[model samples]
Target: MNALRAACLALALVFCCTPPAWGEGFALNEWSARGVALANGLVGRADDVSTLAYNAAGITRLPGTHVMGGLAFIAPSGSVETRRADGTRSTAAKPNTWTAPHAYISHQLNDTVWLGMGVFSRFGLGNSYSGNWPGRYNMYDVGVQTISFVPTLALKLNEMFSVSAGLDIMHGHMYLGTKIPTVAAGTFRRFDNDMQLEGDGWGVGAHLGLHMRLNEQWSVGLSYKSQVTMHLTGDVKFDWHGDNLARRQAHLPEARDCDAEATLQLPDSLALGVAFKPLDNLSFEAGATWTRWSTYNALNIYMKDYDAISNKEWRDGWNFNASVEYRPLDWWALRAGFFYETPVVNEDYADFIVPTNGRKTLSLGMGFTWNNWALDLAYAHVWVNSTDYGSTGASGIRNIGITGGRSKNVSADICMFSLSYAF
Candidate 1:
């Protein structure tokens, strides 16, 4: 029991400090190199162990025991310039880059059954701004990361149909920092307000999938992942640092700790896809995904000493993808894909910390196979649309005159590499 407690404490500390990068609207689609190259169209054409992630039912196609490991590097660049009421502007530097890795293993029990497990990152983000920025009151830095463990079972009932289900156990972590205004002798001045919250929780969800083979040349897939609500409990530390006069005037304590808790509602998603093979060595796939992002409209922070809310005002979104692959030689294959994602946040809800926008991506990749070992490499370039932030912003509390925003541009590049083995 003592060792278990110690291990739990260590994990909480690690969760509070690590940083990871996620894409716009807190979505991560790059699970494997082959999936990335196909723009995540694998819902109907799962040819490897990674299929356990997109559509477990496809696992029936695996003939034996298989294992896969992969890594994704996300490099993002953007600039946010805050415009004060006085017409002055301040530009925030780019945030740090992020890298995520994933692994999966699957075993075929017989002609009708298969089992698999996977560990991977599903969502993550990090943004930190320099001091003295006009929008410091809204946010100076923030980070969030979510990791998941999934166990799946697949059943092949007949030659043309299959079904699968998986259980998702997700662990999440979050951190936030900002500066508040201090009042002294009827004068308003800037003061540092640093707060750190550390915690971990378990959320349960499920994935269901159906794969149908219409004929030898055509197939379609349908899949759904249930939403999860995580209740996270932890400790919160709030510290106020400034001149003695400022601290005294604000009537605040130097530092304090309190019990904290929050509820995080993750979105549920649905996907539909079709695959076609026109030649012995060529294949194409197209798919679409719909996410109920509107469910994540707020992050309500509850503490024994204080309460706060972060409004997201997000909307549902759709993603479209198309991809093709051709094998010119017995040992090598080439692939290319295109994808487009609708915006989830509008100008009024956009913030420096969670800069969201619509985007389009182009991807290219290649794979090589030798005996039971295969290697895949892929690259994607994302183009983001420019956005303007003004009076309509989500930063301020209930209601206040203090509003600071700006125009912004965000773009990113992703590279993924994976190795798989079948025995």
Candidate 2:
């Protein structure tokens, strides 16, 4: 590759591999205000445009043509404090708030068929620390984002059962910044130099869903989202700080156009849910989701001159969620939900890049409908379990020359709003 292309490739890879803000693992669940209010347990009660994301098969419950749009605001707060062997301490800065948006449209085709499409961010993360933070060697900052477009078709076999399938087209981007450690001249101590990389890529996947109405008041749903592997090509560059400890002169020439490619596999997921409606205006649902996080054991980067792999060793994890909806008036509804998720990363692999562990979330929402237009709003809070990364752990920066640390007070607040119109 040319010098310019190589430099871009290197930087892109660094960007693509940073930590993102979302669920316990890397999965993103804020597709719509309704979905967030229900903790994403809408598989069995997909009566609106949001069904295009949770369970396409539920589209059979909608009438005419429906369109919906949503936006989510996420604010993450926490601190990673490094406790050196001698008892000194240092802390990393918190990340800023971020926004994720989504849109969906669906049309009922005759009595037995429906067509729909959805566009949204399926996964993302971003975090940053002070330039001179103690954990700079491990990570300074990272940002990664992904978007997916899914066109779906739902087939109603009968009044009680339906099936749906969709084609997934996804795009992604990444940027990473960090300080590389270098030995000081005439001394054994190490100093830091800045490094940055960025890149973008595309991938394809599939979505499948099934919905079954067992009785007038009970329903069950199942859905699967396939994994997508993004192959990103980008350039890299590094600044040597103009220090020449070896020759008491200028540092080595800047490295540019270092061509590289990284293959990132987004996890596959399966969700099952049951919904109950005992009264005319009240409905409830309980659901579980399983994500194949183990597939992301490492990040493999291929460069023209060499190759590298960042070990992750993530394990599969499960999420349990429950939600309730009450509609006392034809134009108004209330919603609430709760969920718990297990951590995918162990202390062995935990670091400043992704300090998340197990967590629980609670959500509240309200809706208003008039004529063919509707508005929905929701708020959610996530409580994260704190963890300590001591020097004795086999994983983390301690094993790779960076000081060990602990992540505490890790949590996030989310707000979402959606508007829907029917024709």
Candidate 3:
């Protein structure tokens, strides 16, 4: 295959497990938001320039000198409650707040190629439970974050067709903070693990796009991004900080080789988008996206040659999205959309840390322009169904194990704001 084709294949594999079951990238960008009203309507069909996250070729569609930036706030409206076998009920620890930021610059290089650069996050989740949280025994607290950056290039093959590609530079860290209990002669000891898993790694990934202009009022766009693999190497230290201890104990998992080493699986995806303009002032868009979540079967935590635990228990399903845009006048536009997503964690491999499920959502947004500047506003509400599950292990007195799953109406809201400059 050619160099561009090779790059596409490699990058697609890296994104295999990119989306977070808990809460990752903001809902607007990863789920529906594309370029401007004209771009988001077609479902990102004009991948030439909807920020660096979509098709690099989309840069070709932007004005010769243009820049865009935005921020998003996500809030989850529900809580996870667990009941142990002993009839002891407690609420899952959760700090529901997700903050996301994004920026991109697109410029035309002559008439054949366009260049752009962008910075953003792919997946991230931060949940904290006080040391005295209810289900402190099994899961007390956790904080995880990940991000990525990219420089892209778009080439116009001719007036009818164009192609674009990009290289991604990614970095992030993962750490679990919690306390486990220790049992001694007729007494219970509470100690801290203080085991922090962190590392800075880098890898190469790519994206491809094809834009076609059919007649004067119709156009179509398609794009693909390869997955990436990262090797996270860091430090592991454990100590006991408890008073009146009969003896010291440690239940540490070895770090394969060197003090620590780990590999994370992202995932790949394909998007097909289309745009239409029946009138000079009106536009509409509809598109589809598919991700390879089946590849995330497990996560194996190990040390040198010893075995820890496999993440294969996590299962990710498919997702769908649609949107539209309208320009009533020279500087005003209106937009709206719908979303549906399948489950990520399978019935056999579900956890409280990563609570996910089948979900449906409704969203609305609008944009206003003033000479060299433009502003976009959007909001979305999601409804999720409870998940099916089996017991993982014994909780309290063996009789307090996790059981009896119930349907939950978990909900979420998103607020998006963006500023753009045309040069």
Candidate 4:
């Protein structure tokens, strides 16, 4: 690799590896619909047809003809709270999230060659809190979103081997809507609504996967995705939602807002999968996945015209995922899986916008294949076993408050659908 690529790799590791603002340990679980269903069961195997997005090596197993494509819908949720010195409690309203759609397409060139491309969101989550939220004076607002495009290729070494790789051409946008509190004359009414800031940038990255068939009834696979960095730009403004739009506006900070960007920690990941046929007509499989999130030690924001913030523990935790699938016939398949993620932030940095913590998830899905056409659907419900934390000083704000909240709760629900075709 050259200096350009080397520098990019380093930057990607520094920036891209930061986990999403919210998630069970910040794991990026946006691989594919079939993947979400089987909970990533194609680690080192192939379906000999559609759904190869889970394993590039498996694309080479495309039975005879070759080509695949499909899409999915995703939703994200979260909340933050505050505790005052007077034992008073205040909470922010969690945002009801709506994300863009995604799709993937792949092709088999021959018995030993395959190619694919995917336009999907590796991470695009937003956390919105109500304006008059109880913590409006102590903690007010937060929001962010990101997306990427991946092109891939795979080669079948022989009847029992194959490999695939991808380049993550990532593009993204980040919008921060929050409140900067200040007090004067021993009164706190000055703690009003600030405004929102938006920024955007671009970056490049890559990934690789390998597969092997040990025997007719056994197979294993491994895959890795490299993270990418984005340099964002946009206008900085403070729209006082105060009763009078104008009379209450000019009090907002006046920013020159020329060139500025938000740094995000996009984490990389590794997954291992296995498949076996314990019964003549029954095919069973499982998978395990890991994400690199240690890079996110803080939420550091820089502005072209203002001071930045230093938020610690933004990058602290590990996510563990496992899934099982059973195929009883050539035309049908079923799947179920589970996950446990370590908390990403200590009690100190936790807030209403990113109420993310350790969580548990349950998933179920299946697909029907008919010659060159197929339809796949999956449903998953994640219950983050609730947790409580005491002041740890990791958060620059939340703690030392006079009147507020000091408890947190986090959970999620994931629903998806896909219709694909292969010729």
Candidate 5:
């Protein structure tokens, strides 16, 4: 069918013209206000319903039914610079705001068993640039979103330890837009043919957790999330401006919407934490997470008559964090934390989609408890290290090569709040 051929043409254009980095460098760790306030250091001290996300085994610490829900507001800013023989040009990303929401419920089944469920976003990204930006052919506007649902069961083993396991069902969606240059055909001098692709997919994975109460002064927790591979099927739409005669003469396919599919392999991660409590009112925790991002070495998109591939060659990454919490009164608690993350993208394969090296974050927050109701609030500032790109022979869509360039002034701010009730 003509539609099928059109689809194949669109998919072939996708990899031939741009780097397929739609879902990279957008993992989320801000599952709850308390978790963010503690810089995700709560794996060992996971005492609330949010434990379903950090360490489900920690739910053994709760006696009755509990529920918690919240949202995180995020704002990110940055710019990209391209260097050429003529001069240097810079383009700022358009302003954007994103929100991630989380919810969890846990119940104790008898004295040794606990059941819990949670829904939250684990990966996402949203960035946009002007249509005329130098890198428009690589990427002008893009958005990726993912949500995960987990149901877990925990068993308390004596008084010293607990273990838990869960099934992870994840759903992901992506949208991307780029400009196709008609100059390549030699018949049309325009550079405004727009191409847009949108798709959504689902994947299944698993997670495990272990919690230990060593004596009374120190506690330990460990968790692991398995990898998931998603098969995304979507439609690609092309908006062409040149007349049919000129397009035919240029060997350009007719503007049409067609079906396409791609496969993405999401990474797995391991986290460990240790908490110390010198007194009943104070606690300190340290944690680290390792992500196996090497699984994302390549991407492939397929259509009926065409297929394309992009190589990423990304490396593994890590996140280290420390946090402290103090309860001056039985009903009031204050928290502070810090974290540092290592880069995963190899500069040799870096592209405009993710133009940063690593990240550093600092956060502060407070919690209030009254009767059976609890409220938590947190704020965090993230600093992204500037990174150089294009120098390593990176190429844009249509084989437009970038010999040298860099990204600068990258940063983000986050605000989160959560409310919980026990019955």
Candidate 6:
């Protein structure tokens, strides 16, 4: 009991202090170092406590209590270039590093039941550009952070099948900053005011999982997560950059700070995987995940006597991965994997907030086990296809000026480390 309490406290502190970086459409897949090294191919091979986040039903395979904790470090880089009749200009996103933390515990009870708990991030994003960039009117800075807690119960229906259900309790935080233009004395100025919105909220959902041992050498797994909605209430503040005379002559009214509210509809996902073990020292797995991103159709913010609306029109996305593990010795394992994610954002609704397209990742790592302790380490590099923006004339957001730009050289690097103990 004391150990459980301590683990919970540590997870909470880490989540509160660190923000997660961008992943595939802001969805994080680095819940465990082994999962990262395998490109999240563990859905069918959930042999560790980290399975709490992937497929809780797999916990039925364990006989004793198991605990695992880990952190993922992410660094992303990209640049946006705008071409206009006047000239060509390029601006790069500010350098930044972000971290995502995860923890899980699973215990088997009796012969047919298992209990598990996990704390991790499912969705998050952080991006910042120069304040005076060409796309400043669209977005200068933006960040979204979320953490989820899941307590699950798994029941073995028979020797060949196991099923699990869990509740998802999540907390979310958001921040957005943009430049507002003003017309002063019949002259149009690029920017004269700054607007920032900050908010936090809580949401609840559920998930289910199934694991099937078809034969001695083959197994299958399936998992599903329900959609969640968060209603955020926060403050919107505007800072006037123009002098008194300019402010008075401006055509736009001087807006006052006010309380605001918004609703965010997170997506639901389904994953399926198959694993094959041909040899005692080698195993392979393949998996795919589908996300219902269409649920995120729009972004709306309501305030006193004002309203802001943006049309997202995002489409569903998919991720496919394959992984292999080779254990040359009884105490060490080598792992390699790769995954590709389809684009979710429509070109017609492209914005500066998420500046990439379809992405691919390659990863490799190693794990060591000694007695009751295990250590895992992994590294991955992400490559994002260059995306062209501004041709659609639709800036997604109403009243925001269109800055035709092309986002290129977008990429990221991730490092993961974790420790686990079994009793």
**Cα lDDT of model 3 by residue, 1-423, tens digit:** 132122221112111222342331211243223342232344344532344575566667676787777876767645555554556344544547776677778888798878888776666655555565543443444444556678888888887887878887777665544333433323444343433334456666777777787756787778787776766655443334333332332222211112445566666767677777788776666776676666666544334544433344444445566666677888887877775666655555444444456677677787788998877777777676665435443222122355645324456676767777888
Q: Where in model 3 is the C-alpha error above 4 Å? A: 1-48, 88-95, 185-200, 235-239, 242-247, 250-259, 309-316, 391-400, 404-407
Model 4 per-residue lDDT at 221? 79
**Can you give the TM-score per candidate against the true fold?**
0.87, 0.90, 0.82, 0.80, 0.92, 0.89
Q: What would the per-residue lDDT of candidate 2 be over residues 81-144, giving only the tens digit for each residue?
A: 7776666565745669888899999999899999999998888887888877877655678777
Ten consecutive residues with minimal summed lDDT in candidate 4? 3-12
Clashes of 4: 25
Highest TM-score: give the candidate number: 5
| Model 1 Cα shift for residue 352 (angstroms) | 1.9
User: What is every candidate's alpha-carbon RMSD to the true fold?
Assistant: 6.2, 3.8, 7.9, 6.8, 3.3, 8.2
- lDDT string for model 1 (155-224, tens) is 9899899999999888887766655443333445435555555667778898888998777778888888
Q: Which residue runs of candidate 4 sit more than 4 Å off their true CA positions?
A: 1-22, 46-53, 63-80, 90-97, 137-142, 182-191, 240-259, 299-301, 305-317, 387-389, 392-396, 399-409
lDDT of each prediction vs. the true structure? 0.73, 0.79, 0.56, 0.57, 0.80, 0.79
Lowest lDDT sum, 10 consecutive residues, model 6, at 10-19
Error of 5 at 106 (Å): 0.4
Best by lDDT: 5
- Candidate 4, residues 60-122, lDDT tens digits: the string is 766545444444444554444455565555454565654445566677677777777766666
Model 1 local distance difference test score: 0.73
User: Pairing residues by index, what is the TM-score of model 3?
Assistant: 0.82
On a 0 to 1 TM-score scale, where does candidate 1 land against the true structure? 0.87
